[model samples]
Target chain A: MTDLLPPIQTTARDDAVLKALAGFVRQEALGPGEKLPTERILAERLKVSRNTVREALTRWEGLGLVERRQGSGTYLKAAVSPDMLHMPLTLAGGNDFAGLMATLEIRRALEAEAAALCAIRAGKAELAEIERKLDLMEEAFQTRDGMSSEEDWEFHQAVFRASGNPLFEQIIAAMYEMFHRFWEHPLGVRDFGHASFPYHRTIFNCIAAHDPEGARAEALKLIATVEDDLKRGAANLKLSDRR
Target chain B: MTDLLPPIQTTARDDAVLKALAGFVRQEALGPGEKLPTERILAERLKVSRNTVREALTRWEGLGLVERRQGSGTYLKAAVSPDMLHMPLTLAGGNDFAGLMATLEIRRALEAEAAALCAIRAGKAELAEIERKLDLMEEAFQTRDGMSSEEDWEFHQAVFRASGNPLFEQIIAAMYEMFHRFWEHPLGVRDFGHASFPYHRTIFNCIAAHDPEGARAEALKLIATVEDDLKRGAANLKLSDRR
Candidate 1:
């Protein structure tokens, strides 16, 4: 069995560089879009190697915290504390059974909001993308069960994008990525979310019809089906353990 | 003016290490709590120095993606795609005016959900913590304005913790960190959420009363007040530009 590990550690070198960068930005009172000092200058001042600075900046770029211009210097994309840039969104429960339930609860809220927003805001391009993803999901599920299907994931992602809120898309995409990474093996579920599969079309139709309340109701129903599947999967796991 | 930078770059070395770690985890089919190869082993196998592997692991630890025991090897804390491990929750709009508005919109949904859940799930300890934070916020605001007050921030964070969902706390904390970093200077706001201040006590009362619907409604009201502040802030910025 894995040992119970304490959740504390000395700061990593790259992390120290990030912390130094935050200090520098705050000391200089740099606002969004303001150019940061060059990598060489930052490294010299912060007493870290240029590669460390570059790597930290690159990671910040990925997080939408900074922008590195080709000819110009790197600029602050967002005004965030050092701590905010380091850790991605995740549950303390990790990938345990409890974590999955917590994720479902969070998704229940987010998906409902996304569907409602999509219904009111999705444009022609977003609608087309959603429909295309739904078609892909349907075709994929026709050949096989919907367990861990990439198309099913893509359909949900498209719906989030249709919500016209990039934060929802980012947050949900991360959660789904984490969920898909573990859902099949540990749960021993072969055909999860199949019950919720038909709701995709109804949700799409509601959005297409510009009915926010209808879309939200359908999304919640879809989540409820997934929750039921999750409970049943857990029960089956328990039964198999006894056997 | 800051240069318009393209959001594309070659992967950094540490990022390469993280990607390789993900590949390693997948190839080995490491599940949650499964032991990872030692840093020395991973460095040798992945053709990197031990320092790089250690740094990557430390970052993963911060993201709650891995846990490092003292004597035992590092264990996978969560089954997450590598992409999810790297970027914290953030808006694509960054820290600009648009980003603030987008953040407020996301918070509207999250805060209401959090408040409702806090009412249903918060334990006595959590409730006490919430009360403590609210008292601190009240005390801090009595001495001065509430703009960018740490106490005010802590109060909201405590409420999020009471929601019993770590993801909500994580996501909202990141948003507020990013928001607080820029809200004062660019917007020229000396005070914020003052209009929403009294609502905190009311919301706390609802949570204390175990009133989920009331908590949710008051949370929405708090966000609505902030939204009005944002609109007024923008209009004031325009007026100042003319000056």
Candidate 2:
């Protein structure tokens, strides 16, 4: 109980129910789009309330793995999963580093394309928003704001939105959500601390100029700095302590 | 609901709950590892029964987006957030074509890495199993087994597993999962009446020989074959449809 979660008192039943279903997925060799049994049956077998089982099912449904029709049963959605939910499953099964690094590469592909698309599709309003977000970062630098990091994330998020591909925005945003911890480090803290807003300005300029190459170069520059900072941290850390 | 999924019913409540949750993710500004309210509270907020909420929550928990503690409460997992549950969310909000292509390119990069890793790390047992699976496909050519298509997937899945990178495996697996639907065209289908197991054997050889370039090239060959088949299908009507 305490070992599995935060030692909460109320939701153990739900957790147990989900555990049962996941166990079923494992043991029964169910693939996506495969439907599970009725709550009455699952509850009777798992020794939980139908309410508990239903709650567990709802959570999974929310995650987009389970698709339900009003009169139809729940079926696994093989294609509808988000990356935010997948990384941890990989981590749990063993392969966190591979997942993270691969994700960074995925980011490079996505953001590079996102910047290009933003340059092409961003309207005056979206571009203005991007510029405004960049300005916010500048203000953060000037005032030494604690939330500068967030400002940075927001600015890029602004770009993803401007790219006009909801899927791009969502996927990149989801990756950021899952990997925020990896991206946030002692070096990142320092980089964000004294980091000039000029790099962001470069991105803004390239985007505003509608220069795809320039935008990509600027994006790469930003990633380069972050990578360099991360590398430096790795160099400075003790062998056993580094992630 | 019947129109959406006519094949099942028990899963509908759970599916609606997930849809509601996906709507929540699409609508809310929740961050990873952020806890929602207790089951009773969340159920009331979502207008679903506590059981429904619990079901969705359980799914999320299994997906690794939320961690459930018996006595404390369920906490959002920072690493495996809700965003990663589906296809690239980043692609959703953007302009068409360009952004979509960019997302696919990012996928290509992931696939390349996964293929390379699979070449390097696949075990004798795993390698042998992949060969066995491929052999099954060869036999399927003779008997016209229903398992041929599925065996194809297992072969790729084995490659991912052998990569020893959970993230790579899962992401690559998901990408493959997404691409699988385009298979049933008249020109393709591994129907044996059209192609043979040798196509997969090329990939197997490269991987077993630990030649990353070879594995990649072989994979490209397979993909190209499928692509050509799809192209051909477009030029001529699907045989099944014609019938």
Candidate 3:
């Protein structure tokens, strides 16, 4: 039972400090705009170093949990409640087929919207960058037996950025990294279908043509194909492992 | 000129080490399956403490950049290129009107998809949790002149979780946190319209009925209202500042 519980003290001292401070705030019933104790005081109360407390506060500031005013003191920026304390700000990095499928669903939503937005909003520089990434992907396909997943990833990232929404780029990049953790082969390998490769160019053309609906349709079709391919790949990998 | 460059040496020693190691990988043109040098050697080369090196490697493992086999050495799981090193996995935390609007665009994409998925995949328990969150929001609305943004946030979080897609929940949570950093008032204030408050029940009813299309349509309509209200709020805030 003890092993089942996570060790409160570990190398992740900053994370531990974050939890401790959150607990302290909750116990005190601190509300928004309420000033928190000094870093030194928090360190002493938590029996940790001042640097650790500072690091935790800095992270909290980034998460909008607290605000540090110059010389005024740190204050709560939002209400700290029991449920909010444990809300993860990133993916839990699950390594399973279902996790992969769920991530793809998110990608489908993001990618389709991104393509439409890019069609309407991509600037000349952004469009040029997209074209450059596409050129690189084409080169890789021509020269290699298998498409370069890295190049393919870069192409999609370019499209996401062209959407002019940084959140889309950030979230999709994180998903790409998380998928790499458990996938045995490159993610592109699972992207089956001979027509899938050319769809990249078609999607690009829609964006360049400034056809938002066309771009959205093409992106949706592409992801739907990738989803079918992923199902097939999962089954094949399962059979091979069993053999 | 010196001030223009970010200090390579800072309290974020682990991040510096990450950059150093990524540079080393690129210089060596290391590909997947290539083994990295021992920690001691890497620490010596980078002139950092062994602990820093270990922390960097642990972070890299989490990012799926490297894999450490038990009793063996760390190996590159994917190609480390110039662009991959600079790619940010989180938002840059822009504090401006355009940034807020951009984030809302992402929310629209994720929220619509999540509501649709929740309608199809949410279990009885998840549906009960969603209803419970709605009850809390309704109670808050009944007692307060202004809606509680926190309650509203919790309600949306429950819906995201009910989607059975952790990515949707994680990404949306990050965006919510990012927006809070700069917004002067509660986010829910921008959620205008009498119909808007009632839309929550409509959304919940759609999900409860297991009507994915209805849920998706309602979610999109709600976000569209929020977006328009946001534009109006921005104009009002600008006018007030001028006054």
Candidate 4:
């Protein structure tokens, strides 16, 4: 029975303080615009230093959970519901497989839209940069031994830039970082047998032709290929576990 | 001509240090596995303290631009392309219209998928919770209010939770916070004549029937309504400007 138990995960003192403060607010049934105890009082009640309380309060304020009046005191500005407290998408450090899959799905949606937008909005300079990247990719395929993840990343990034939406670029960049850090293989790595070049060419052609729907379709197909690779990888892990 | 120019946005010393380091790396054309200069050397070259250099390096590491090896120096682990440096999605503070629109489009994509997933995966308790939230929404519509943003928020949050992917919930929560902070009107606010209640009811019916496509369609319709409202609001602003 003891062996079957899950390992205990210790919470940091600061996190504990934050939880205690959040719990206190819940227990008191604090509503929006309601005043919270002063830092000194919260510190005394929670048995933590005033600095710890202040730090937690600052974090809460950033999360829009609380508001601090300069001359007055901190007040509850938003009702921190149970669902809000259970937010699991902290892109802090490290990555889990499920989180990676979730991120990939998000990428599928955003990148498809980005490709469509790029087809509509890309200027001559932006289109030339994308063409340059594709040419570099072709060169790498011909000269180098394998596909270069760096070149592949640049190609996609160029498309994002051409989308003219900074938000898409930023989200894609963050997702790329997370995927790169977590996966054992670098992003955009195609196996020797995987004919990914044709898909890239198709996507490029769509953009070059200024076909938004076609670009979107090609992007989705590309992501679906990546998804299939991930699923196969996961299946292999399960097989190894059984063996 | 100089007076006609926009005011310069002052860069903080730390941000300036960070930018300078990034610029140095770019100018040097640093590639993967290339070791950076010692902290002492970097600080000396950048005309900043070692602590500032360390701080900037730490930020770069978090952004996945570099890697620090134990017993060895920090090395450039990724190609720092110009586009990589121009990532615009800062979920920091404040709200810009373009950012909000980007977030809304992302929401449309993710939430539609989430609703579909909820229809397929939601357990009994989760389904019950969704029903309860819908009931609360109806009550809000019936009495005490025209349309409470809080109730609307909770209703959508419940659907996200029922989707069984914490990633969806977290992303939605972050977007909600951003939208809430920036938009003059709270998220999901509609005019009394807008008749959003029927759409919510339709979504709930689809989820109850486990119709993934129906749920998705209804979710898309809801987002489309919001998008139309946003477009109208923008048009009104332009007309007012003309007036």
Candidate 5:
């Protein structure tokens, strides 16, 4: 049982400090412009050196977890995702909505690569995994009469894993995790096909058949379809404003 | 004199601990296969409690700076890139190559956003700054009759700033700092229009006109052109194989 929990076993004093700080901020539901506890008090409470506290603070800074004031203590800034994709966005210090769109563009590129590589790299085991995710997604689509957000994510994650590149695998994972809110808080019902399954199936087919061009085409078609929705949605807002 | 030193000003005990460990690691010139000092000896030499040392080690783990094994002490891992672009390809991770191409593809998406935003958001001050860079680039092109890698970077740096989106601005700054290596390192001698300045000017011209469509087109053309060069140069083994 102890060996099974290697991930959280030690958790390290500094990591504990960070996790504590994050949890406090999260539970309070702070946003940008919120204040955090003073380092001296936190240091005393955490029973670690101020130096150790400072390192944890730096981790928060690197993650865009807080806005530091030179003479004042750090304040909570953006709410961090419970996922890794948001880590790089924060690590890169991008917060604006336009920046989020830029992140999506990056995803487009990775998804294309994922499709192409999945075509070549995915073996029978990986193909079976993709097929399993596809079936799960289809079931979610059928039962929910809409794509469950979690199911949508599971399908993408499967593709990334199939790419045979751990870096791409993890980077894509981090990105999806970071953008969980945008996905979960749907502006409208997601189009599973007309609304999800063919794009998924087409991508899966290309991978299973080991056809790179077909995979790339299918991936682009998926992104293009989504971008179309975003465009129409933006236009509809303009029309509603005019009315 | 103190200011000339690295940013290690907080506490001597902690700084001494970190610096000593850094020295020990450097002595081994640690790489992927490298092993590091044991916690017992490291604590003894640093004159800190094992708990304090463990906290410091945890900080390194968070940054992916070191790895820990169940039976073994922590091993030295590579540092993350400060200049994100020029980051050596191997830093993409020893085990992943296809992932790297996908990552570059992602970067291109972010770059396109920066260019498009620069078209809309740039002010007169920004345009003037871009023009100033253009002047220097012209000087390099006309007088030197060869590449001006420094000027080449300055031009793009100006464009990222012109975007008025600090998120894109800083990202491009960091990424290009890494990409600048290709300018001086390999002389593919692609030619004037094909090289940096001409394409940059075309991009500059579109942005100056506030033509978002034109700007995006120009930005993409320049990127596609370079990507072609990257693909060709890597294939020909002229760009270090990017392997």
Candidate 6:
């Protein structure tokens, strides 16, 4: 387990402290629900201040890796297992183009599968919710309300919810901001009106018809359309840069 | 943004404080690198103790959402954009069977796509690494070293690396622990010898041949084989429970 975490950079004392505490947890082979040594003990062991230990513990708690019981002490809420994966693309810093493309690729895979699952498993209420969102998109298109993007997002989220896999919903939800940003201000594509409404409606129709394969195809097509737009936009940017 | 974050269950004062800080950041539309108000000011504004504010900031820092600078103050390191997605499944708690199934389904989608991408993008060196892992798997089988599983994992990881998408690698890497556990002591499945060697070889061959669709098909077939075993194992468990 210790081998999983790379060496901690000693740039910040707090970061080093956090890494040390994580190392301790990994070294001890502590699993979820395990108790940790007291802060004083940890501070003494790591040769760090108690305040540093406290801060690190607090941070771990926030990350959902540990839990603190007021009187009992802090317990390992989740094990930082050696095999656990880390988030590769972070939205924190300015978005990297490669990261953005990688993210879109992932989204395509997930959303495509989600559409298939929604076709097979979506309940009546869920289907209705999706339809309602579609109606809102159409209404926005007709009224020029410029709210189709919001409705479109809701429609996709409805598909995720209908997939009945909380993990899918959660993963997509986690990328919701990135996806939302991409769709609204899509790099090269300017028009956000009813351009993609037909594709979305075809997706809806496929799901409504209980055609998993068809829904998957439609979803992929929809994603392809966006990807094309992004490529075109990127090319335009390049051309402009050259000019 | 409030609509995006579910109500924070007020189980602990610190949790409440954390939620409030998150809310403040959202309401104020804090972006990445934005400076947060001083701890003293935050405590006064949120009506929480300074200790509580410190604890919450520490937690946020741990979560990679904020950064604390010794002399300046704490600043938002990342935007808590309302559109941001949240991780749906956590490996911290005991692994629930449903979560496991959901995770496998996700792995299937990701790995299948990764194989396709690898077929299209992998360079000669990347292909050689994958081939090396396969050779190691075969050697383990012949030697009866029982290290086939590790080599098998390496093979899949190599595919992810070949995909040229760091995000795919990261997501799979995150799920490594779960996948490792699933393969090792799968509910009822045993015999981790060269049983799936043919399927893996076919996947490798497809990639080497630069056949994206074929590689995808082979990857899905490989995943389906495992899924079948898992399903059968799950059924066996259910029957045993009934007995």
Sliding window of 10 residues with minimal summed lDDT for model 1 chain A: A82-91
Give the top-scoring candidate (lDDT). Answer: 1
Report clashes for each candidate as comma-separated counts.
0, 66, 0, 0, 9, 7
**Which interface RMSD does candidate 4 score?**
10.9
Candidate 5, after superposition: displacement of residue A43 in Å? 26
Please give the TM-score that candidate 5 achieves against the real structure: 0.50
Error of 3 at A176 (Å): 2.4
Name every residue pair that clashes in candidate 6: A85-B173, A85-B174, A173-B85, A174-B85, A174-B86, A175-B85, A177-B83
Off by over 4 Å in 1: A1-87, A143-148, A186-191, A239-243, B1-93, B145-148, B189-191, B239-243
Pairs that collide in candidate 1 are none
DockQ of 3: 0.13
lDDT, candidate 1, A1-243, per-residue tens: 225486776767777888788877778888899998998998998888887776677657656688888778898877766434233664543545667787787888889889999999999999999999998889888877564368888898999888978778877766765677665564665667778989999999999999998998999899999888888878877755421
Task: Give one digit per residue, the lDDT tens place, for model 3 in A1-243.
Answer: 011212246767877876666666677777889998888777766677786677667656645567887678999976654334222233332455676787889889999899999999998899999999999998987786444556877899999988988668766775676555534353344445444678899999999999998998899888887787777777766745421
Query: Runs in model 2 with CA error above 4 Å?
Result: A1-57, A61-89, A93-103, A145-147, A182-189, A192-197, A239-243, B1-106, B112-165, B185-243
Clashing pairs in 4: none
Residues B1-243, candidate 6, lDDT per residue (tens digit)?
A: 233333344557676766666667778788878887888876766666788778877756655567878689888866664323333234422254565777888888898889999999999999999999988877876676444777788888889988987667767776777767666566666654334667888999999999999998998888877777767777767755421
Local error of candidate 2 at B232, Å? 9.3
Ten contiguous residues with the weakest lDDT in model 3 chain A: A84-93
lDDT of 2 by residue, B1-243 (tens): 011211213545655665555555435545666665677766666566676666666766655566877678887664442224332221221122233244344454445556666788888998988888878777865576443666666766777667665555555554443444333323343442244246578878888899987876676556555445445554454343432
What does candidate 4's lDDT look like per residue over A1-243, in tens digits?
Answer: 114475576645556777777677789998899998998998998888886676566556544567888779999976664323221134321244555677777788778878888999888899899999999987887777555556777888999888887566756775676666544353333462154556777898999999998998999898887787776666555534320
lDDT of 2 by residue, A34-100 (tens): 8878778888999887776776666566555577665777787643312222322333311234345
Going through the candidates in order, the fraction of native interface contacts each one reproduces equals 0.31, 0.19, 0.24, 0.13, 0.03, 0.34
lDDT score at residue B189, model 2, on the 0-100 scale: 32
CA displacement after TM-score superposition, residue B82 of candidate 4 (Å): 33
Predictions ranked by TM-score, top down?
A: 1, 6, 3, 4, 5, 2
lDDT of 5: 0.62
The predicted structure with the larger lDDT, 1 or 4, is: 1
